[model samples]
Target: MSAKRMQLFAFFISVTLIWGCQLEEQEFIPDVSGIEAEVDIRRFDQALFQLDTNDMQPELQKLMEAYPELSTLYFTHILRANDPRTAPDGPAPYVKGFLQHESVRNLYDSVQVHYPNMSDIEAELEQAFRFFQYYFPDEPVPNVSTLISEYAIAAFVYGENDLGISLDYFLGQDYPYQKLNPRDPAFSAYLTRTFNREHLTSKAIQTLINGLVPPARQQRLLDLMVNNGKKLYILDKLLPYAPDSIKLEVTGPQAEWLEDNELEMWAFLIKEDLMYETDNRKIRKLVDYSPHSPGMPEEAPGRTANWVGWQIIRAYMEKHPETTMQELIALEDAQGLLDASRYKPGR
Candidate 1:
């Protein structure tokens, strides 16, 4: 009824609205636009399977002749010999069996059918590599080599100057050979979400980043979370064109749930004081990749702690505008980052 009371009411309402808007507002990290570097990803899988050879010896010799440099890696690493002692003696006796196996042929055929021309994926790799070179000029851009493997466990394997993609691993989720029928949670997670073509480039880039910036020391849970967060943040920067789901490696609903409960998740971590706890079980459950994060509600996605840590790093970057990507990568002090972040959620 009073003039001052009405003014106070309007001011409070405006404050509430502004605060709510701030909570909902996501900081837009820009994509690396118009990167010109052309990365010609070498197709090791194609070269390996080009010949329909019942005679393994000649084909093996031809492969060695074709890719002299990569042949060593292919034999030693990819198609590992049953006996390594006699290995560069060329095709071990069992090599014939490996080459002629129906499963092996099927896997090779699937990859060939799925990825006839990797030009688009190559361009995506080139763009990500360009950003990497842009940020860290001293580092070398690795030569990409795509191949198929029996295990398909390590989807993207990296070395100092070479990157390898396991093609069979990316042959869509429902690929009959995926072993999803075993009903294992871990296998299900891999097949349902990660085992897809879209994830290849992102995984490759992340692997490169990981090699450059080794995992932070895991003395405390906070350290692990921050390190994981750093990786995700770098991934976000490198693959800016990638959707949040792909970058975060979460489903659509999972991403949405995390975004909605970001503030609540932060509060839960603080209240529980799990950030600095040294218990491996608790830390793994929170930080490691799983179907869902342990100790949180069923609605929460896996790695909620890492998500919170990413937000903290994002907040810290916001507060300290001078912090470069390289500096962020090199940053080892989890506590310092958390303090600098001044990350008060739902404010």
Candidate 2:
């Protein structure tokens, strides 16, 4: 037989095999590429607002097309343009192949806060979630107790004196929505009630990122991560504060770890169910590492008065015993916060 003829025969066989292979449809997983969840909602929202959605990067466009789960990037671009300068009336002002859902577009304007605030980001995220809801309403809503646990986890990471939003906002609500629970474990309620769904997803992702998810609600997630051992936590804002190694749901034969630190802590902290203690930890941890002890500072430009001051106030109260939580939180000794090392242990 001629060599060219043999090559042609081989090529036809290869084409036949390629055409004969059956490909399974991939399950829908939320898209969260290149986004960090630990960021205060404001900054996260700001970042979204800043991306030049009009950019003609072919790869980024391909990424978006192949990974619609990350549609949040487009949303962020729309959010930036939502302003009068960009959109005199509304978002999606003139863009084609863009989405501008009501949940995100009409998310009420945010208040100007001096400290890190999570509300704007949270609200906008909730609005963003409407897309997910549109995509998967039948998928189970995250457990409320699970949500609270995750919220608490995020609050702890935010630390004291951060202008950033924390779980306290929800616990203080006058009217909380229906409480939801996971079906597994003992089938007990995770959150007594759910005041907000955006908060729910945010906290859940935060907890997962921080290794703080509650055990009852985490079993299925853990099992999935263990089996597949791929990327686990979902919040882009919270990812910056967390370590790189995460617990992902297992599938397609992957290596698994015994536990995911961020995820485990989220569950442990939630099951403990002590907001005040969690708050105390939030304040204390910030002070311990942020400025007082000076192990690391999260904000790059170095905002000095955040967690350090709150830690001093909380420590003073813990030592004094009679200090009220409100008074402690409201304390205004900027110098004292800066000089937290004076009160550490022996001082």
TM-scores of all predicted structures: 0.84, 0.21
- The worst-scoring run of ten residues by lDDT in candidate 1 lies at 4-13
Tell how far residue 108 is off in model 1, in angstroms.
0.9
Error of 1 at 68 (Å): 4.8
User: Residue 229: error of model 1 in Å?
Assistant: 0.8
User: In candidate 1, what are the lDDT values of residues 172-257, reduced to their tens digit?
Assistant: 77775436356645466543568778888887777777776777765687788888888887787777778888877888888888
lDDT of 2 by residue, 66-153 (tens): 4343233333332343356765654444332222334223221211122135455454444434332433344332211101122222
Model 1 Cα RMSD, 1 decimal: 7.7
Cα-based RMSD of the predictions, in order?
7.7, 26.6
- For candidate 2, the TM-score is 0.21
Candidate 2 has an lDDT of 0.30
lDDT of each: 0.73, 0.30
